[model samples]
Each structure stands twice: as C-alpha cells, then as structure tokens.
Target: MRISTFEYFTSGVSTMNNQQASLSNLYAEISSGKSLQTAADNPLGAAQAVALTAQAANLAQYSTNQSSALTSLQQEDSTLTSVTNVMQSIQSLVVNAGNGTLNDTDRSALATQLQGYRSTLMTLANTTDANGNYIFAGFQGGSKPFNDNASGVGATYAGGPGQRQVQISDTRTINVADPGSAIFQSVSSNESSPVSSGSAANTGSGTIGPVSVTNSNDPANSSTYTITFGTTTTGTPPTTSTVSSYSVTALDPATGTTTTVTPPTPYTAGDNITLGSQTVAISGTPASGDTFTVAPANTGNVSDTDIFTTLDSLVNALKQPADSTSSLATLQNALTTAGTKISNTYNNVLTTQTAVGGREQEVTATQTAMQTTSTQTASNLSDLVSVNLPAAISQYEMTQTSLQAAQQAFAQIQKMSLFNYLSS
Candidate 1:
C-alpha cells in the first residue's frame, strides 16, 4: 500500500500538536493545584466540588452562630450568679430581722442594707452582653430589663416575656436570654402586714402583724382587717387588768369602708383571726385599747408583689418603731412572712440558672459538631478538586518526553525529499 509523503508529514505534525496540548494541560494543573479547574476538565467532579463548597460555607456560618450564642449564654450565667449571691446576703438579713429584741432603729439599718442589695440586683438584672444587648430582656435586647423608681423602693420589669434563640446548627437552636418576669416577678408573697402597727398610746407590750393567708381566695381575700382590744378590771381589788374582749374590723381595700364585727363569742388573746380569706395567729398578752392590722399577701405577676415588693415592704416595716409589744409583734410577723417569700424567690432564680447552664452545654456540643462537619466538608472538597502534586509532575515529565519524540520524528519526515528521489 503506497502512502503519500504529504499525508505522512501531516500525521506526524498532528501527533506532536496533541502531545504539546497534553503537556500544557499538565503544567496548568500543576501550577493551578486543581485537577478540575473548569467543569469541562471533569464535569462531575467540578459539580461535586461546588456542592461541597456551599455546604462548607453553611457550616462556617453555623459555627459563627454557635460562637455568638455561647457569648450571650456566658453573660447571662455570670449575671445570674451575681443575683444568687445578692439573694444569699438578703437571706441572712431576713433571719436577723426576725429577732424580737431588735429595735426599730436596728431593723431600719438592716432594711437600708437590703436596699443596697436591691440596687445591685437591679444592675445585674439589667446586664448586657458584649453586643450591649440586655441579657434578661428576653427578645427586647435593647431595653433595660428592670427599672427602679427614683427612691429605689420599687422596680418594674420592662422586657418581654419570651427569650430569643439562635440557630447553631441545622437541627438545633439554643436560648440566649432569660426573661426578668420569670426570674424576678414569678414569686408569691407572704401573708403579713406590709404596714403592721399598734395603737400609739397603748400601755401593753402587744403587737399586730400581716395576716398570713392560709386559704387563698382571689377576689374575696382582698380586704384589710383590724383588731381592737378592750380591758376589764377583775379580782375585786382591781389591781390587775385583763383583755376582756376585742372587736375585729374588716376594711375593704377596694373601698375605704370599714365593718366592725361583734366580738367572737369569747374574744381572747393568742386566738386565730380570719379575714380577707387569710388567717393570723396572734400570740402574747395585750393591754386594753391596743390595736393590730392584717393586710393582703402578694400574688404572682402583680408589680406590687414581686421580689422588689418584698424588699420595699421590709424596708418600710423596719422604719416603723416597734416601741410596744403590739408594734414589736407586727415587725416580727412581717419579717417572718418576708423570709419565706425571699427564699422562694431565690429558688425561682436558681431554676432559671439551671436552664441557662443547660443552654451553655448545648452551645458547646453544637460547636464541637460544627467543627467536625467543617473538617469533613473541607476534606471532601479537597478530594474533588485538589491536584495530586507528585503524580501531576510525573505526568508532565512523561508528556514533555513524548512531545519531544513526536517533534523529532516529524523533523525527520520533513527531510524525506521526494523531489531528489524522482531525480535518482
């Protein structure tokens, strides 16, 4: 079979051109460090790399979210710890206030200390994170959670009821704040006189206190009641006087009206007084004309009955002089009731603190998972697009050698002079 010289030379040239193209491609891959620079090189691998890139980007975003959640949770936990510490100090004061020997002046001083603690508590409750978002404001991050009036005797929660959460992962979200309402406003108050007192000129060492509510009756239990003692002379010589009878008066808190009920059959000291769906057990002796009053206890959610309310009531009760037994009794009784409520409020704070701890744990776990996912995603993306450097260099050397051989053979073919052969 006769082959044309032109065809032979053209075939050699085409062969070298293909070799050169292959060698250039290997160099490009080595320099670029990407086996699949474009979809045309390896369409399926390039497509897979794109998908992996998006997944990795999402994972990175989730990691950022996890970091933010952790910061907020840490801030919240730290403030809650401060709150707990303040509450512990207040508990000690509550115990000391219950002592019967404390004078009105001594109790007032303790109340002043309590007020300082309240100020500190307000600061903690209104704490903000690194972003300056209020930690206890729930979703109202920009608003202060607790606001105290100028006198600092009372405070109100200004934030929302629900907290905000961040998505740390595709399947998980974590709470970033705890609301003040749940931590500070959810406590119930004790049944005692926020304003207990005795008749100013009474001669007996008797006192009256807030009525402790034994049976809770919502609307029916709102009246404030008062007790007045009467004395009678006895033992013929009349040297000794006894509290013979006492009348109980009910004053409607809603209306300023009063109803003095007839003395209960035997009106006696150390008897149980029931009014406003609440009860009061008064102990100790009382002189004639001595008086005591009982008022409503706190119910949850009433701004007038929050933890701040308990402290304010204590401060006011302490300021009053417990000069007589009746006055002393009122102070002691109010202190006892406040003690229980303070303990309960502390417990409520602890419950939320526990929840905050749980959220912190979730943040930690989510962060670890996100890190793992990010590593795997990066590996998968590398596998799909990254070039094997050593192997690419070997292929480049082999292609260069083949291209040189093709060029040499094509040059030898070009020298085959068909015109000289025809002359021979």
Candidate 2:
C-alpha cells in the first residue's frame, strides 16, 4: 500500500500532540509535587487518600476533646480539695464543742468560730470555675449552690440534684460535677418542742407554778423513752402521775421525716425507747395537769440545712443548761450523726475525683493511639497517591524522545510520497 501526504501529515500531527500531552502531565506532576493529580491519574490512590484525610480530621477532633476534658477535670479536682479542707476544719470544731467542760461562754466562743468556718465553707461550696460557672452546681452552672440568709438559722442549697458528665473518650464518660443539693440540705427529721402552761378550776382549785422538764439522752434510739403527764388530781401534795400511754416520734435518717410510735403502757420517765440502732432517754417529771409530749428528734430538711447547720445545732445543744441533760445528750448524738454524714460526703467527692482522673488517663491513652494511627495512615496515603518525582521525570523524558523520533520518521515518509519521488 502507498502512503499518502495527507495521512503522513495527520500521523505526524497526532504524534506531536501525544508528546505534548505527556510533557504536560509530567510538568503538572512536578509542579504539583504529586504523581497522581486526579482520580484519572491514580484511581485507587485517590480514594485511599480521601479516607486517610477523613481519619486524620477525626483524630484532630478527638485531640481537642481530650484537652478540654482535662482542663475541666483539673478545675473540679481543685475545688473539691478546698471543700474537703473546710469540712475537716468543721469536724474539728464539732469535736471541741462536744466537751462537757465547755461552759456556755466557752461554747458561745466556739460557736462563733464555727460560724466563721461555716461561712468559709459556704463560700467554698459555692466556688466558681475560671469560666464563672459554679463548680458544684452540677448542670446548673449559673445558679449559686449555697444561700445563707445570715440569720444563724441555717443555709440552703438552691441547686438541683442532677449531675453533669463529660465524654473523655469513645468508651468512657465521667461525672464532672455533683450538685449542691447532694452535698447539703437533706436531713433525716425535724422536731419542735413547745413549752406551755394552763389551769383548771371549779369552786376553788386555783394555784399554779411554772413546770420545768428536761431531756438527757438521744431520742434517736429505741432504748430511749419519753414520759407524758396526764390531767392532774388536786390535793395538798400534788397527786400527778405519769401518763401510761403516749407516743414518741423521731426522724427517719433516710427520708428526712418524723416517725411516731406508741410506747408500752405506763411510759415512765427515763424509760428507753428504741429507735433504729440508737437509744434516746426521756426523763422529765411533769407536774399534774401538765402534759409533756415526748417525740423523736427531727433532722430538718436537707435543703434547709447543710453540714454547717448540723454542726451549729450540736454546738447550741451542748451550750444548754446542765439541768437540760436530755438536750445536751441529744446535741452530742447529733454531732456524731452529722460527722458520719460529712465523712460520707467527703468520701463520695474523693471517689468522683478518682473516677475523673481515670477517665482523663484513658483519654490520654486513646489520643496517643489515635495520633499514631493517623500518622501511619497519612504516610500510607502519601505512598499510594504521591508520585516519585525522579521516576516521573525520567518517564516524561523517554516519552518526549519517542515522540520526537516518531515525528522525524513521519517527515521522512512524507517526503518519499509518490508524487514528490517522481518529480525528484
């Protein structure tokens, strides 16, 4: 077959275009520093790079989350430490006030010191983080946890019972805070005793003197009992007898409510009425015609009182007149009970702090692992998609040489076309 001029020129043009395309691709790879510029250049590599990039981004986000969680945990740990210290100080004060040697004046002085500690503790409980959020407010960061009216009555916890947690890693979460209500204001019971007087007269039963009654033991235990006075039988010598039937009530520590029960008949003064595991004594002889009601001690509402208030109550009770023996004993028992509660609360705080620390450690481990994984993935992606610059350069040069040789051959063939050969 004889080659035509048109076909030869067309072939030469196509060869030149192929060389230009190859050169352009080589130049692009060099300029972009990538052997595979698009999916068309390296399909599998491009897909792999996309997945690797996503993994890297996720790792970055996890790193940020870890850092934030660490900061929050540190702040919480510091605040709880301060709170624990304050509680310890209060515990010491309570112990000192329990001593019988302390006179009213001495007790008053201790109470004053205790009040100062309570104020300090309140401030600590209501401490805020660097971001101005209450550390112990749980999820209610904007609200103050403890509110004191400054009336020496007690303080109240205004925050919720809910807690807040943070996700430190994929498989772990930790409680970042506990609410104020959990720390204070939940009490077992509240009891109020009112002093009253009265008179009964017919034609001539008409003389009276103030009746005095006092308590000397904790009414918290079933071993302790109370005596009540029934209507009086008038005579030269007052013939007033103790009421045989009467009820005594105390607060349930768990529910913070008063529980009442009737003692066996002939409830004598100084009889022991068992309440839970503790014992309370009722030992006040009431005048005839005077009714003395004996009831279990009430632990006020937890929201109405905190650890500080309980300590204060104990201090006040200790300061009562020695003749008010029951009141003194009740106060002593209250101190013991309140101490247990405060200790438990402090332990809980410690437990939470430990848990938070553990979570933070896990976050660190996960972050380290993720970082390693991301680095390896990124390197693998580079290997897959990135071109070897030297190799690409060599291949482009070979392709250029081939295209030039093809162009010269086409030119020689065109010159030998039949018409040009015959004219020569």
- The lDDT of each candidate is 0.75, 0.59
Q: Which segments of model 1 are wrong by more than 4 Å?
A: 150-152, 188-300
TM-score of each: 0.77, 0.66
Residues 1-424, candidate 2, lDDT per residue (tens digit)?
A: 9766787788788888988898999989878888777888778878888888787776677677777777777776677677778778877876776687777788778767877777777887888877898977877888997777577656766676787776644566656676766555432222222111111111111111211224434434422222333442233546555343434444445555765555434545666544344333444443443232222222343522356566566556555554444444444444554555555455555565666677667667777887787689778877876778899989888988998898788767766756776888
Whole-model lDDT, candidate 2? 0.59
Give per-residue CA lDDT, model 1, range 286-309, as digits (tens).
666667765554432365347887
Work out candidate 2's RMSD over C-alphas: 9.1
